[model samples]
Target: MYQLSEVESNYRRLFKDFLRNSYISGLKPLLLHSPVQYAKALWLAFLAVIVVWTHIVVVNLTLEYIDQPTEIHMAPNLVHVSNSPFPAVSVCRSNMINRGLMNNYAFKIYQHQTQYEGTFANDSRYPPLDLERLTDRLMLLTNFFLNTDGKHLDIDELGQLHNLLTSYYNGSVYSVHDILRELTPDCGDLVVRGIIYGMPVNTSQLFLKRATSSGTCCIFNYRRPSYSQSPGQRELDDAEMAALPQVVFESNSILNGIQFVLQDTHQDDYTLSFLTNTAFRLQIFPQEDYATVQSNKHGEILVDHNTIVEVPIQPKFFDSSAAVRGVTPKVRRCYFPEEGRKLLNQSYYSLDECILLCRINSMLQHCGCASSPMAGTALNVSYCTLLDLPCLMKWRGIWNGFNEYPYVEQYEEGAEDASSMSQCPLCLPNCDGVNFEITSNVAPLRKAFNATGYAHGLLKSLNNDRPLSIIKLFFKLRFAQSTQMAMVGDWVVLLNRFGGILSLMYGFSIISYIEIFYYLTGKWFVLYYRECHKQKNDSNKTELDSSSLHWNE
Candidate 1:
């Protein structure tokens, strides 16, 4: 018990010494006070504890905020260039199919069905196509190419119609692409004239046939190869690159961009009311990106017949800062084009492109085929016909889910859980890209033409009452706004904040921490070893004295 008390006293003495010599602000005061000043010491110690707690709380919150890593903000300055790349302009007639061609196709189908009616009347395996419902059937068949959500025919009825059509064409059924090209108005007839930078351009040479959700449309200033071509053939030859349509504007004037006169003449009998309009559907997008009906839906504008529409575009480009690029793509919540391509296994990367591919992949996984309006020709995937519409319609909600949240979680193949299967979480937005904000100004076409003294003879030659639209696309500003992704609280910032909080709370620095560590480890261990050695020597000396006393006695 005496040895135990001595050890406790020694420990108390060591603690008091540590308190007196410690670099911490309030600790020395606690040890220096007398009994009468004990309350003052306690109050100082309590305030120090509150400060330390506040410091811990603030540091934790700062760490939590830093975990997010990235934020999007407008750049400090606008970007100005000598000349900006022109946007790709796509024009689709609201009435997708040609009325005369549709009528002819319908009549051919009716005649074939009547011919096969007697032969397949009693065969349960081969059902006869309904003659009275031919129009509805035709609409259903074309709706697949239009990419519109319409009422679909029954699976059995669609199969019956497909079999009938196959029989009609002598075992060779027409694909949706072929039928749309055959029935849709020719690009020559649709684009009456094309002008760029006040110079007349050959409409045939300027416009290219591209597949869109609203069937085939003519697009200008598009650089990418058509979906029908191989993905490897995207690199254009020097001549092809030189031949691509482009416009340069010295100023943001209405006359500095491309203009077109579009004509739409559809018969009432062949045109569906919902699909037909007296206006042109114009889609404006970046040159490098694919123009899709779903992605460019917000960019679509209407150019009414006999009206001149001016579309002024404001471009905004987004870029990643060096700090943001230091982090992983997942940390930043976005991907560079190369990163996205690697993840998605595609030739190009953009949010729209990713989402479109995601939807197409979902279709292929669920229905075993992609629709005609979808892009999978390079993969050699079968296109969905009237027979596959039932399957496609059944999973329409899943497709919509992908469209709404392209960055949702992805699932493994053939997963039985339908609830977890609809997400496509890998479709992250591109770190850098361009987007165009467009606004339209409309006026009477004849009045504008008369005032400008242009296209007088062309207007006179065409029927004034017919549905025609004149569209002009130009830039509204010389400069574009750039959005930047920056690190909100990187490691450097977090360290600075942590150090500041530490210093504010306890007047601490790196050396203070080192000092505390030395005292607790190296100094404390050395003192303990010395104390044990001294105790051993004293005990040995006492034993020697006892031995001597025994010898004397």
Candidate 2:
């Protein structure tokens, strides 16, 4: 704004000069020239005021006609950090339900989450975690984490949210796994596997990751370009989002949310006939090195070790795996090649054989494999030459990934059971030969299955470990030859579903029928002998008579 004195000085000088000049220049037109200009200016000001008022009123009326909702974008904030290098770490925020009955601690939980921006983005972890187990541990140790994260989640804040989550998810008698029931259902045959695949926030190829011995840890510090759900739906009407229960995970953040498997192995390949086709929300292997890629031109089956699976990304806040212990080898003793179970089976490796071998491998991995203490020292305890020695056991009733959980094996009404479920019995209270399950995609899977045998109560124990596998239609199949075949059973179930054949009983195939009939009747040749009655007296008499006749002749 111009100072009053400066404006007044210019107006007075210019106004006085203009008035004097006009008054003298045009005698007739100079009448009241200064006052006339002032009157005109006042009229123009009134018109300008009216126009400005009209513009304000129109804008106000237009705003009243349109109701625009506030816009808010929710890009899941997944985080990961680990103290141990090999075992990655993750944390994330999740939704919690009222537990049917509300608790006083509810606000405490919410308050803890608040105090941030309007969007108090809870951390969702990408590292793997068993919801039940992690929650259980958290229930036991809550205060520790709350105190720890109090330090803050940033460099300025020295605490972490890891401890905070574990304590919040302990299972109570009323404790329900809202996440499990929603994610892993009894009737549903599915597994959700996710991986923290990295991508850039911009159009760069560099995957967002932290530096490590194995190149970079694909932690949440980097944006997951394609892993998150598609953006901009205008409304949050997704059932999964609406029904998301309180996660019993130990995290405030999560990693990439991409998945792998959607179907089992055989559905897409002939080599995997025994395997029913199914898909997992997150299909992952025990080892990350073999992260499954669409091995074919089209991204489909994940295959390795002559085994195939539906690939899935590592999900948020999930950690650990089918733990395989390290081995402490002994004399790594000298044993005959035939001593191996492969030779003992002679027919093919049974499910029991597979477990023993796999268990051995797992144990070896845990026992300081590179330099085992047992090597060249304790021969008997460290290395057993015979796998089938009297004491050497064939563990049965062990679980497999084949069957869903909570299904306990029951007795088949009329069928005579084997002497024992497995060749080698297991300890009581533990699943031995009687309770066996195939949980992974292993080679020669059919070689280990019974053509016509299944565990009745298998799910009873499986519920303690894995979810179901088969889809609904697999069991609903009716073969044209079902009448001839007689009894049809759920051979191999996937994600707790029955569809494909994991095994077949003595199916009346041409070869099998021939093999059975050969032994029933003497179809080939059978040698028989009958003792001839000794006719000693008749022989002697006949001889003598012949001699006499010869002499007479």
Best lDDT goes to which candidate? Answer: 1
| Backbone clashes under 3 angstroms, per model | 1, 111
lDDT of 2: 0.24
As a whole number from 0 to 100, the lDDT of residue 163 in candidate 2 is: 26
List the RMSD of every prediction in angstroms: 5.8, 49.1
* TM-scores, one per candidate: 0.76, 0.16
Candidate 1, overall lDDT?
0.67
Tens digits of per-residue lDDT for model 1, 222-330: 7765555323333332245458656565656666777788877654633653245656778887665666534432467777777888898877778887677778876
Writing each residue's lDDT as its tens digit, candidate 2 over 353-398 gives: 3333333343344331211111211112232211111111112112
Q: How far is candidate 2 from the true structure (C-alpha RMSD, Å)?
A: 49.1
lDDT of each: 0.67, 0.24
lDDT of 1 at 64: 75
Top-TM-score candidate index: 1
- Model 1: how far residue 387 lies from native, Å: 2.9
